[model samples]
Target: MKFNRRTFIKRLFIAAASIETFFLIKGSISKTHLEKDKKELFNAGKADSFEKNKPYPFLTGQFFLRRFDDGGFIAMSIKCTHLGCIVQSNIKTGGFNCPCHASQFNRFGEVLSSPATRPLDYFPITIKNGDILVDTSKPTKRKSFSKSQLTYV
Candidate 1:
C-alpha cells in the first residue's frame, strides 16, 4: 500500500465531515419533537360558552366541549397522532374521528381502534385569570383515562 500525506489528509477530512453532518441531523429531529406547533391560530377564551346542543368546535382549546354525565368536560387534542392531521368531532356520533385514516377517538381521547395504538395527546388545562387556559408545552403521563378529562369551554 502506498501512503501519501495528501491522501491521508483527504480521508480524514471526509470522515470528519460525515460525522458532523450526522450529528446535525440528530439534533434537528430531537428539537422538532420537543417544539410544539406554533400555529395555534385559536386562543383560549376567544369563544363564548355556547349551549351543548349547538355544533361548534370551541375556540382556543382543541375540540368541542360537551356536557358529560358527571357535568365535567374533556378537552381533546385536534391533531391526529397517526399523521398529524386535524381530527374532526363527529357531533352526531358523539366522538372525534380522524378524516385522514378514519381513526376514531372518543371525546376523552381514547383509542377507539387498531390503526392508532395510543390515544390523542392531551393538553393540560388550568383556570387562570378568569379564563380556561390550555398549556400545550409538556405532555403528561398516560393514565387510566376517562372522557371526563376533556375540558369544557
Candidate 2:
C-alpha cells in the first residue's frame, strides 16, 4: 500500500476516463429521452371552441385549424409550398395567400395559382375527449385536397 508517482498518475487517469465515459453515456440517454418526449402535439383546445367554416390561426404552432360545417377539422401548415414562405390567411375570402410569390390557396388548401404545384401541407388531427389535437411534428404533403384528409368528430 505504498503511494508511488506512477500508480497515482495511473489511477487519476483511469478515474478521469471513467467520469468522461459516464457523462457521455448520460448525455446520450438524456438526449434520447428528450426526443421521445418531443412528440409535439399541439392542443387546439376543445372541439367546440372552433367555429364552423372558419380558419383559426395558431401562429406559434405555424398551422391553421379549419373547422368545416359538418364538424370536420383540418390542420393546414402555414408554410407555403412555394419557396417556404409563410402564407397569410384571407379572412374575407376564407383562403390562404402567399405574399412571397403570390401563390393562392383555397380554404381546403388547394392550389389556385402557379409557383406552387402542390397544395398546402397539413398535420394530422386527433380528437381526444372532445379536445382537438394537431400533430405538428410532421406535416403531410399532398398534391390536392381530399375528403380523407379531414378529421371528423
Q: Which candidate is the best by TM-score?
A: 2
- The runs of at least 3 residues in candidate 2 whose Cα sits more than 4 Å from the true structure, single-residue gaps closed, are 1-38
lDDT of candidate 2 over 1-153, digit per residue (tens): 899999999999999999999999999999998886676789999998888988899999999999988888999999999899999999888999999989999999999987988999999999999999898987899988888999988
Lowest summed-lDDT stretch of 10 residues in model 1?
39-48
How do all models score by TM-score?
A: 0.55, 0.76
Q: Point out the worst 10-residue segment of candidate 2 by lDDT.
A: 33-42
Clash pairs of candidate 2?
none
Q: What lDDT score goes with residue 7 in model 2?
A: 97
- Number of backbone collisions per candidate, in order? 6, 0
How would you encode candidate 1's per-residue C-alpha lDDT over 13-110 as one tens digit per residue? 99999999999999998888666554232345632453443334654465444445544444556777778678887777676788888898776667
lDDT of 1: 0.62
